[model samples]
Each structure stands twice: as C-alpha cells, then as structure tokens.
Target: MSGHDHVRFLTKNMRVDLALIAGMIAPGSRVLDIGCGDGSLIDHLFQTKACDARGIEIDMAEVTQAVAYGLPVMHGDADVDLAHYPDNAFDYVVLSRALQAVERPREVLAQMLRIGTRAVVSFPNFGHWLVRWQLLATGRMPMTATWDRPWHETPNIHPCTIRDFFILCEEEGYVVEQWLAADDGGRRTPWRRFLNLANIFGEQGVFLLRRR
Candidate 1:
C-alpha cells in the first residue's frame, strides 16, 4: 500500500504517545523509531511530514508486516542495535511505550541521543494515582489501561514515574526540551503545567530530550 493509504488506515489507531512524539519532530527530517510495531508511526511521518522515517522492531512478525506495507523496518533489539548507528544519524529517535521493557533502558536512551540529535520517549507512569490506589486496594499489581497485563506476563521490567524520568535526565545531563503527561484518550494537554499533579493523575509521560 501507498504511504498515504497506510496513514489513512492508521488514523485514530495511532497510540496517543506516538502522535505526541510525532508532533515534537520537525518536518522533512530523518527519524528512527524503536519498538515500532507495524511501522504505523513511520508511515504517518513519511506521509504527513515528508520525513525519512524508519523503524526497528524486535518482533519478526511485526517487521514482516511493516515490510509488506512498504515501510523500512528491520528486526532488531533497542538494547543492542542502536549502538550500530553512527553519531547524529537522524534528527530524532523515538521510543514509545517501550522504555521500561528494554533490559538496559538508560543505555538505550544514551544510545538514542548519541545516534540522533534528539530523543522522544514515552512510558507508562507507575506513579499515577490509579496505579497506587489499585495496588493499595488490592494488595497486588495494578491493572490500568496502560498497565493492563499481569505482572508475570507484562514486558515492563523497570517501570518508572515521571519524577523518576526527570531525575534520570538530570543525572545524565540530558536537556528536557519538552515534556507532558497524557492519557490514552488522546488528551495531550492536561496536567502538563504541574509536575507533581501530572505524576499523580497522568497515565503516561512523554519527553523530548537532547544531550547537554
């Protein structure tokens, strides 16, 4: 299918975090998306912004699906594959909803900033009030929309909060260009102005960052 057709098929189907990450990227620039399931974001970027968008997905099934749809997605792991790219190879490297799943998230993030001018990362906020409330009420792992899978079955290993991410950025000397807390319902603006409030209420945290 054409890029336009692929994008049309993906409208409203794109994850809220992916849309937010796309908005942070400039048009007509190179983009690399990690854990890019079926290359939906890449298709959207290529069709709408004229970006040279490509992706790497660990799942061979997803890689094949993306390739069938004419997307440039390779089977690769973020923990290892990112090191092969040269410095500043792209304008942006995006990791949407997959940071916590990577075995070495900090290293992956560093590699992303190394190979791209900027990095956009989005992950479920473990500090959300709903998560806390659920855990407290049930004495078990929470199961919200973002964290739906059972603890034993979930891919997330090092789930972090918005505050935790901010601290990591500070420790790594990465500049936070922009950040926001958004929900799955496509509401991107709520609680963005208040970090503490966002940590309590926001379902997820999206951040655009660059190395200091």
Candidate 2:
C-alpha cells in the first residue's frame, strides 16, 4: 500500500504519535520496527513518509494482520533476532509501547542504537499520578487503555519511570533529541517542567533518541 493510504487507515486518536513519527523521519528513509504489533506504525511510515519499513513481531495473530496489509513483517522475538541485522542498516528503529514488555530493555535499546542512526521509543508512563494513586490508595495495579491487562497477564516486564528512562539513556550513551508526553487520547501533556512530579501524573511519554 502507498504511504498516504497507510496514514488514512490510522484512527484519529493515533494521529498525535503519527505526527511525532513524521517529525523524526525524513522522506524515503529506511525504518525497522521492533515488536511491531499489527504493523500499524510501519504502514503509516510507508504511506505517509514514503519510508521503506520492515517489522519484527512475536504474535502470530498480529503478524497475520500485518501480512494481510502487505507489510513486510517477520515473526521473531526482539531480544534474540534484532542482533542479526547489520550495523546501521536503518535510518530509524522504533519501539512503541514495546520497551516495557521486554525482559532486557537496556540490551534491546543497545541493539536498536547499533542498527539505526536514531530510534523512537514510546511507552505508557507508570509514573502517572493515576497509576500511583491506584497503587497507593487502592493497592491494585492501575487499569487504563494502554495498560489494561491484569498484572499477571500483562506483557510489561519492566515497568519504568520517566526518570528511569533518562538514567538509562545517559548510561547507554544516548541523547534525547526530542521528547513528548501524551494522555490516553494521544494529546500532548506538560511534562518538561514537572517530569519528576508530572510524569507520575502524565499518561505516556515518547522520546526521539540518538546514540552519543
């Protein structure tokens, strides 16, 4: 499918992240999407940015959906298969809502940096105030659209804070080129001034990072 068609398929709620992705990617760039569930983002990139996009997903169902759309997607674990790609093979690598699910986030991030000039990472912010309130007051894991699964069934293995991500980036020699925070509807939130405090209340966070 053409890039324009892919963009049109995206629901209006997803447009915010799509805009952010468009800002990071240049036209006709090569992209690799890790844990690309259903290939929605890859399709958007291909159609809107004219990108050459490929994806790696673990779920057979999602792979099927991606394939139905004629997207190039391989069924594989991000932890094990990402290493097979040559160094600097893609202009950008993307991990949207997938970082928190991996057992080794640091390792996966390192591999992303090695294989791409830049990477875009987006995840639900556990530091959001509602989540904290749920844990503190209700003593139960929060259930939101992005994190709706029960604790036992949830794919997230490494729930992280905004501060935690910054620390990891520093340790891994990555620089945050751009950062954005969003609510459930993908609307931007004010996180820069009150990241330490606001992140606990924010909904989600997205980062555009480059290897230092």
Candidate 3:
C-alpha cells in the first residue's frame, strides 16, 4: 500500500507523526520501535500491516500496559540497551518523539542504523518560527502543542531543528530517503519542499533514513 493510503487507513486520533512513520514501513517487514510508549505503533503495524513489530520502552509502567494488551514490548532504555541487539536484527528501527531525550543522540542514531536497514525518526522542530519568536520576545524557552512543557519539567535535552538533523545526517553519512514537515493535525506543511520555509513553519519533522 502507498504511504498516503496507509495514513488514511489509520485512525485520525493517532499522532500525525506516528501515522507518518507507519506509512513509511513496508507491509510484513520487521520493525523495532524504541521508546514505544504503550506500543501504539507496534499494535497498528501488527494488526494493519502484518509486520513483525515489537517495542522497547524505558518506562516499566508502559511496558506492563502494553504486555497486558498482548502486545510484544519490553522494559528497556534507548540510551544503553540498544547495544544488546545484534547487528541488522530488523528491517526498520523507529525512534519517534524521543530523540531529544536520549543522553547520547549521536550514538543512539548510529546504533539504530546498525541494527536495522532503515530508521524512521520524528521530533518537534525547535526552529519553528513560533519557537524563535517566543524566545526572542520573552527570552525564554518556547512552548507549543508539540513542545508543551516548561523548561524545568520537560524531558527534552538535545532538541534540534530540521536543519540540525539534516546536518547530522550529512556529517554521519546517513542517506535521507524521504522527509517532510508537519503539524499534529496531520497536515503537511505547505512549504515542506522548501527547507528554509518549512523550518520556520513546521511544528515537527519526520525523516526516513538509511546508511550510506
């Protein structure tokens, strides 16, 4: 099925980014989701796409909840536990909305590519115009629907812009196969084709990548 069609197949309530990530995976592929809170994506992949989908979440509470639902999920940390997996264990390794919280973002990304043929990542764009304007106007960290946490209370530590991620990919020799900017409403930013404009307007960025 086409990515757009897969997006349509999913419930509207799923986070736009998660729907996008789901769209990227091929049917019946193996997928591993890091920081898979509640295993929502895993459930969707298994049920809708017939994927061998499982998750590793840092929160034990979420792990238990996922297990209770009969989903395959385990309590594990993305920062350190990723190393336990063998090389090229899955077709896709997904890290959604949790990139900023990992203590070693670079290392974690390297591990993702090492263990899977491709990686799908989505994160809030810290370079959105609203974020920049709020910081400039109020001299404080900005908050939006996607970044709805106070500075002291938020788990994000390495928040990055779309441009920043592109640079990282380039520097690390990772190939960006597909990318887009969107908001929580599932609407792709009109300027998604234009990086500069998208960076200023997109609430979040989603990327499909593979090793060079």
**Candidate 3 lDDT, 95-209, residue by residue in tens:** 9877877789999999999999999998878999989999999998898766676887667778999999999999999999999999767678789999999899988889999
Better lDDT candidate (1, 2)? 1
TM-score of 2: 0.87
Which 10 successive residues of model 2 have the least lDDT summed?
1-10
Scored by lDDT, model 3 comes in at 0.85
Off by over 4 Å in 1: 1-14
lDDT of each: 0.85, 0.77, 0.85
Checking candidate 3 for backbone clashes, the offending pairs are: none
Ranking by lDDT: 1, 3, 2
What is the lDDT for 210 in model 2? Answer: 93
Q: How well does each candidate superpose onto the true structure, as a TM-score?
A: 0.92, 0.87, 0.92
Residue 164 alpha-carbon offset, candidate 2, angstroms: 1.1
What global local distance difference test value does model 2 have? 0.77
| Between candidates 2 and 3, the TM-score winner | 3
Candidate 2: residue pairs that collide:
3-46, 3-47, 3-48, 4-47, 127-200, 128-200, 129-200, 129-201
User: Using lDDT as the measure, which candidate wins?
Assistant: 1
